[model samples]
Target: MKYLNLALLILFPVAWFAPLLRAALLPIFGMDEISVITGLQSLWGSDPAFALLVTFLAIFAPFAKTLGLALIHFGLLSPKTLPALHILGKLAMAEVFLIALYLIIAKGAGYVTIETGWGLYLFTVCIIVSLFISHKTETS
Candidate 1:
């Protein structure tokens, strides 16, 4: 777990930056664009319900994890921060994976034609690495 956490910590920074880096290079290099991974693009063209969905997910998701982390850090919960971080990271990854799955399925079904944006791949990698790190560091 500790090793995983360390790996996550190292990868997390990379993931965070990968999307931006890809975005910068894609247009210049003339790469085909695709669905969004972690930015406002996901919100674009979404229905009104999407706004509510985003709000609910955004608030509740981070709140739970951040609260748990706070509890542990402030002595309200366990002394370690790994569990909270891991669980939060898991939640984050689940959401990203689901979105990616949805996009892939949509494209396969002809509902949408994705263009393979570099940001999506980078974001996916980021979430996966974060999950691994969180799980590695998590403790009972």
Candidate 2:
């Protein structure tokens, strides 16, 4: 469980910078790769409130939960905090749903092209692995 949590700590950042989507607003322009970091960057310019929400879910929740769990594993934190960490993991998972929902809406518009990137899978895997690690930590 400790090792898995550690792996998530490293992989989460990689997932953030990796391309989660390739999107082209118009065919004249080449598709641009969008990672979590890039998406958040643009989002902040247009909608700071929504960007704050996404940043919490996409960046803070999972990473904090993982770090908190690591602290517990290393005897630096109370295991009593595990339940709160579990909630954080669940919140992080919601970001994936939001991404998918946006993709569906954008594709439905019939004017944009959207393609899933490997980073989507990687991000999702990191979320799930963190959730599993949380569960295992709680159980053990």
Candidate achieving the largest lDDT: 2
All candidates: CA RMSD in angstroms?
6.4, 1.0
C-alpha lDDT values of all predictions? 0.48, 0.93
Question: Measured by C-alpha RMSD in angstroms, how accurate is candidate 1?
Answer: 6.4
Query: 36-86 in candidate 1: lDDT tens per residue?
Result: 324334564576577456533433443455445445544577646565566
The residue pairs found clashing in candidate 2 are none
For model 1, what is the alpha-carbon lDDT of residue 1?
Answer: 37
Best by TM-score: 2
Error in Å for residue 98 of model 2: 0.4
Give TM-scores for every candidate, taking all chains together and pairing residue i with residue i.
0.48, 0.96
Cα lDDT for residue 14, candidate 1: 51
